[model samples]
Target: MNIKVFIYDDNLSRRDSLKALLELSPELEFAGEAINCSAAVQDMETCFPDVVLMDINMPVVDGIEGLKTIKQNFPHIKVLMQTVFDDSDKIFECIKNGASGYILKKDPPQRILQAIQEVYEGGAVMNPSIALKVLEYFKPQEQKSPLSEREQQVLQLLAQGLSYKMVADKLFLSFHTVNSHAKRIYEKLHVSSLGEAIAYYYKNLHQ
Candidate 1:
């Protein structure tokens, strides 16, 4: 199957170059291009591409914010961050905001095509350096995630500044059961106090 893709980047030269590179693949088709996040959003509504190649440093709403909007509104569209910088902060922020891949601006055309196909197959792609950073950052998150889904829901509600009674009412469960869920959530998250739990919740709200 041919994968349709949209390109978003501020630089005209880079955007066109990337588009040219993507066209070389028989399995990939260029859907459209946008100069900024706002334009990208409009293009997405019209074209509905399977994947988006986004640049991290754009005017108005940067790639990170743009990515958040895309993931929230169009969950099926995979986003790949393409930037010149290989810094860990940008990589982590992009992944946290639901980017499916990260490729350096200098990466070969074949590599970018491969990254697109990888994400299409439900696998995340990252530069080796960025991959290492991702593994390091997510290790603690995985450790905190061993809780059941109900427990997680209860913890999320409580962390949103909701009282136990409110959470129980929202979940339609007894206060005692809600309390048990909260307790288990705290234990699994390795947090000793409600404040700590809330802190963790705020920290990992996306995951």
Candidate 2:
């Protein structure tokens, strides 16, 4: 099946240009176009495009709000934010609001095509700078574990980044017992990642 796409941008020239570039792919079909947020939403209902290429700045509602609206109303239609702004907050907010992908307006046409494909395949895309921003934002906020004394020993050895086998050997515990303790540690801490567990340990140092 052809990948149907809708373009939402106030600039007629940009919208047409994007359409022309994407038309090069036999697998992609231009479904429709909308100049502003309201029209975009209406067009989405009408066209039901599989993916939407949306600009950040529009005449009335702007891209972010339009993205939020589209995602809210048409949850299955993935919106790929096509904008000039590399601002971290904008990217983060877009993702938080259900944007499936983000790409700079200045990116090569090829990259935009790839982004659409990625979003269609259930993947999230973001500019490299935007990715770094997310990492920075989450780095400090990542959760840490609160293991008990014995659990802490198990985790500390694990934090040394030891493998389960090594931790089991060093702690002189059966591998099965060590695995059970690790599972409990993960549950008590409410953490899924080792980095979060490590950060948790430092945050509650007084404990």
Candidate 3:
């Protein structure tokens, strides 16, 4: 399906350029365009676009405020932020305001289109530099795992080279119960495989 896109930029030249780029890509459809997000909810309701390309700076209602409004009114619509300034504060503010993607105005047309498609398909997108800034901003906070005692026991046993059956026997649990505990452990640790779970266990142990 062609991804429906709406643009909200005050710059006529930038809006025109984006429209021209959309015209070239068969996978994208230019649903609508607006100078600012003054009528953001009304315009979005009118177009029902799958994704919105939003400019960070606008005349009256800025993109950050616009993003918050759009998300509040239409939580399902994905909004991708665009800006010339690579300011980390604005980028983080957009993210906190529920923007699905962030891109620089200097980014190539193809990258902008890719960001649209990605957000439309339920993926978040960000420019490399913006991503780095976001990472740095969030790197200071540590995420604590919410593993239960039994789940942690299961992970520790798995890390110690014990198979699920062996762990079950040692812990006096049924095989199915042990498997369930292992699954919960993997989920709490956010690891896909036993190896990753074991690695996480050892990494935390040393930390």
Candidate 4:
């Protein structure tokens, strides 16, 4: 079945160009178009499109507000944000507001069509440059686990429901050695019990 697409952009030329591009694809149907998203709720109700191509920087009602309005009123519909700017703040805003994909307006027509189909089929799409920026934003937020490799091994065995004796037998270590490792693991993780240590392993250390 062809996926129906709607457009929300203030530029007549851009909207027209997009409509023409959609017509080139046998798998896509151009449901409708709009000047801006000031009447986003009503416009969405009228089109009921499977996907929306939203220009991110309209004059009055920008794409971020329109994206939020669409998601609130019609959570099932997928919205794809298109913009000339690679502004990280707006990219984050659209994502937070439930945009299914983000792409540059300068992207090739084929990429845009592919993005529309992808979002319709329940996949999130991002332009490669945009994806790199997203990765860069989160790079500094990843925390390194402080547990040593051997301690992590002990924790992994414990997480797999092994007792201290069983862990010692598997690793060919003394039971006291496994017990001592368990105590150090708990101290390093700031967890008190075996269950707590196992939970921390799953939450932060297990990889």
Top lDDT hit: 4
Score candidate 1 by TM-score against the native.
0.65
lDDT of 1 by residue, 105-149 (tens): 899888898999999888889988778877787676444457678
Q: Candidate 4, residues 12-66: lDDT per residue as tens digits?
A: 9999999999999999999998878899999888888999999989888888999
RMSD, every candidate, angstroms: 14.4, 10.4, 11.6, 6.3
Ranking by lDDT: 4, 3, 1, 2
**Candidate 2 weakest lDDT stretch, 10 residues:** 140-149
Off by over 4 Å in 4: 141-207
- Tens digits of lDDT, candidate 3, 104-147: 99999889988998998899999999889888988856746577
Model 3 pairs in collision: none
Question: Whole-model Cα lDDT per candidate?
Answer: 0.86, 0.84, 0.90, 0.91
lDDT, model 3 = 0.90
Task: Show model 3 residue runs off by greater than 4 Å.
Answer: 141-207
Give lDDT for model 2. 0.84
User: What TM-score do all the candidates reach, one by one?
Assistant: 0.65, 0.67, 0.68, 0.68
